[model samples]
Target: MYSGLMSTPERLIESTRELLWERGYVGTSPKAIQQHAGAGQGSMYHHFTGKPDLALAAIRRTAEQMRATAEAVLGGTGPAYARIEAYVLRERDVLKGCPVGRLTMDPDVIADDELRAPVTETLDWLRERLAAIVEEGCAQGEFTPGLDPQQVASTVVATVQGGYVLARSAGSPAAFDTAVRGLLALLAAARTPASAPAAS
Candidate 1:
């Protein structure tokens, strides 16, 4: 359910996003979208070409939202390690799993290049952004020298995505919390000691 103030098209897109997260592309029927959105079949057709078209819009919106959320913490003022820590520790629906990450598992979404672009692009962007942060951390001596920025970035992304799967599997948020704490511990170990020499 959505706000009454939202336009029909907005409601349709929001509904589709929720359905897509709840059910994969194949499981999310047009009728279900219309019913959830409180829009008539005619209204749905009038705003978008079809399910694919509407789904693409929903996916794009979700991707954009994800990027915005990450940027809020990653782009904030702080040492690089703290910023990265903030990102991982941010609140989320651990049991429900990631909204964008879930799409990666959807066969229908993965098969279509058009549908998959946003998902892939969003993930790629996240990795790149995190790499930049890690690189900055290395420069600031927040992390030890010789740590590969790109690799560390990928690891962070993998941990969060993998943590979601683990949490959902066990039906407990504790699994996700354990994964995050473990990563933080590893990162803390990687921190450069004040007495350590800078890379020549």
Candidate 2:
């Protein structure tokens, strides 16, 4: 029953990714995926061993795409602080929340190691990448000394994830904007150096 630009396997993966994003692992079903992909049960079974197997494939693909997107901004040319700021200020789907992070809230997915590995690894990679940048900024005096890179990285991640929650709760992006703005102000203030008095 699969006939489209994408092959049966590709359609299954792509459909699973969207369904997982829109409806977490627990909510997504094999029938729903088959329907979304316009594939029949036989086509789905031919491509994947089962729902979990297909879901893992979808989760991995989503995580990879997510990482690539983050790397585009974080790895761009600029001062470390600038890179971090750009990442923080990067445009996002405020209400939809993070794909990987959202998976963490899914009890079924989190309970299954195979399903959770990609999500956990992706987030860890992001945190470590951010920590590396923060450490570089501190070394370059872009930030005040004694600031912990890991702590700052974790805070940045938390702020973004928390912003999504806040935005969703309020039914608007205002809360998200407010959190980001406040964080940026703090970061800016932290980087400001105290000036010496003019010569008498």
Candidate 3:
């Protein structure tokens, strides 16, 4: 799934990332990675110490990509609620599920501290970033006072991850859309009235 121009190491990482997302850690074998990357076993070994090392690189790459994508929307100019909406409604492969979230379900990945670190860190960063936006929203009079930013952020993350599970189970994106719609509705309900004071 890579071009000839890509370096062997780059190809290996990219291939592993896709395989891990699709098949989880247990299913992704070194042979499969080499074959997918069109690299020889020698090339794979030359770049990485072993599967764990290669998997960590792939996981880190995926996590970095996820954060970059989220930051693009969350960091954009707009009301906090609007930015959150953009994040929740952002296009995704609902059926394939979250790349990082899937790792949390993989036994091998979770069992390995090094492999799991990126996944855990990525999710934690997401919650914190979202919590910051929520706190900003409250400050800007966009959301009602007394809303806990951290709680709200966790709910948002839960909804998206849960939505992916629901969508995958139903074999339809409708489940995901419904979950997002419900989240938006709740967020809308939490908005402060136009006449309300910012501090109120």
Candidate 4:
């Protein structure tokens, strides 16, 4: 059985994504990428001018993947809250942080707009999409009339991103879980009638 050949550029981009995830932008090197991808220096050079060029490609690919994931989670059947819960509760390596979120902390990656554009666009789009769903929920009477869709959407994203940062700093996944639980609780509270007294 043949494992089908991968072009040098494709291998390099895939390897770069892994390296970026594992070690970050500055931590990853061209040599390391070549070695990991099983491509020669010339092969890499033939396709990319340098690390930045390759990183751009890798970031774009990662962004596309993130968008697809969001669309799949937020654009499907079920209520907005349930779909959002599915998005957050779906299996993930919370300890590793979001691929898109991880890029935000990389100094080199964030410093270059060309490199960071995809990350920014991806996160912004996700938030907007979620906000639209929340707005829809409000209109459908699934959520409180006073609920602010934009605020809730931003909070949802913030909780996840901030949770990752906290998890990495604390060296445990507890922070991430707490964040998710807290967000869900807030959403649940919002679903109750305004006249209902808060649980003691």
Worst 10 residues of 4 by lDDT: 190-199
lDDT of 3 by residue, 106-179 (tens): 99999999999999999999999999999998998888889999999999999999999999999999999999
What TM-score would every model get versus the actual structure? 0.96, 0.93, 0.96, 0.91
Per-residue lDDT of 73-183 in model 1, one digit per residue for the tens? Answer: 999878888888899999999999999999999999999999999999999999999999989888887788899999989999999999999999999999999998899
Better of 1 and 2 by lDDT: 1
Lowest-sum lDDT 10-residue window in model 1: 190-199
Superposed by TM-score, candidate 4 places the C-alpha of residue 52 at a distance from the truth, in angstroms, of 0.9
Q: Name the runs in model 4 displaced over 4 angstroms.
A: 1-4, 192-200
lDDT of 3: 0.94
Provide backbone clash counts, one per model. 0, 0, 0, 0
Number of clashes in model 3? 0
Q: What is the C-alpha lDDT of each candidate?
A: 0.94, 0.88, 0.94, 0.87
The weakest ten consecutive residues by lDDT in model 2 span: 190-199
**Which prediction has more favorable TM-score, 3 or 4?**
3
TM-score of predicted model 1?
0.96
Error of 2 at 70 (Å): 0.4
